[model samples]
Target: MRVGAHVSISSSKATSDSVTPPHENIANAVFRQKEVGGNCGQIFTHSPQVWKHQEITDEDAATFREETEAELDGPWVIHSSYLVNLCTPKDGLREKSIDSMQKEVDAAARLGVEYVNVHLGAHTGAGVEQGLENAASALDELDVPDGVTVLVESDAGSGTKLGGDFEHLATVIEKADLDIDVCLDTAHAFAAGYDLSTAEGVDDTVAAFDDEIGLEHLKCVHLNDSKHECGTNKDEHAHIGEGYIGEDGMNAFVNHPDLAEVPLVLETPNEAEKGFEWDIARVKELREN
Candidate 1:
């Protein structure tokens, strides 16, 4: 059960602990993960909304690595900036995306993080073939460090977005010169019309993914329940078992032998005072042996 939430690394968000100077730095994420009863998790180096990248002091990076190694079962992932569009055909946007990803991977190496998660982004009328080519070429430009791997995440199939289909994921991996992997977002996959709302649907979707992209390339699972119906293409996430992918579907997905060892990171929304702690507990409960 390598499960955790996408915890914040910002020092501004104080921890729930009574200790003074709580949530001091990025290392605070280690404490935050424990607070929510999570063993592994994800974080953003800075605000994903902005283009500015935060510089991590060597001390901060070392402390984060040391504490995480000592306190938690870790394979921490750095989620890249939301603005990065590796699929964009526009020259300016593509260059910025490459630059942003380069900094993120460098940051990952510094922090001893194992993976950098990112979306393939919208094709924006460039069409699927061109967008995939653009993404592959863009990834080829990155000099990813020895320990870190970039994971292209699945997307909610909206407008001209890519990575929603299993074929899209397979294509990117096939076309890219640099070795890469994937992070399958449950909510996004559901929105993209991969039915995950029933036991049968779960089997079919898993088989489809294996057939198209190969399960070996799936390094992570963003386990979330979708707010909308199976094919709605909506990206909102609900609590673990309360949304369309309800108790039965979730139980089947979590207990499936093929996914037993894959890390599950919750991107579920908070409501009624229920947050990561509640969601993590729910996931553990749903997962039988």
Candidate 2:
């Protein structure tokens, strides 16, 4: 059961660490993930709110690679900024999105991370085909390093956002000239109307994904529980087992054989009572040894 959380890679030690530190700069994510009992995880290079970029010194990047190889069981994924909207029809925004993705892929190379995760953003009235074309072409602009692969993530399907339907993911992969993959966020899929609340639903959803877009492309799972009901198009994440995709759904998800080898990187909420540590522990408890 390879499971972890999205730990902060904030240069500020306090924001990055949940445990006491003998920490080294941005490499603190490895320490933070270990302390939270996660063997695989995700990180944001800088704050995702604005368009700013962050730097990683060669020394720190080397240390991060060394410690992660020695400590973690799964690959690291860098989540791109929220402001990146590849599906946008606007010219300026599309350029910004491409540049942002380029930075993310480059950073993933420097950090020795395997995947760079991003949303397709919204179409904003470009319609589905044009939006998908925009996203694929935007991704085509990047000179992604050899080892790192950009993973287009599933969306919550709110408004004009793409990637809710499995076909949307397949379409981008087909259209993009660059080699890419998928990261299925469980809560987002649920909000997008793919049932995952029961054993049958989980099985059906996996089958649908396999049919629409081969399972071989599923590189990661954002193992989260949804705060909203199925098909609500809401994207709030709940503590594992405490929301609409409750204990049964979570248990089924963690133990599902089709997803057994895929790393589970949680983006669950940090509540007063339960956070990453608690959720990671819950996942361990759910999986059969």
**165-192 per-residue lDDT for model 1 (tens digits):** 9899899999999999999999999999
Every model's TM-score: 0.97, 0.96
After aligning candidate 2 to the native by TM-score, how far in Å is the CA of 110 from where it should be? 0.9
Q: Specify the poorest-scoring 10-residue window by lDDT in model 2.
A: 11-20
The per-residue C-alpha lDDT of model 2 at residue 226 equals: 92
Per-residue accuracy of model 2 over 65-140 as CA lDDT, tens digit each = 9989999987899999999999999999999889988988998899899999999999999999999999999999
Q: Which stretches of candidate 1 lie over 4 Å from their true place?
A: 15-23
Instruction: Estimate the lDDT of model 2.
Output: 0.91
- Number of clashing pairs, model 2? 0
Clashing pairs in 1: none
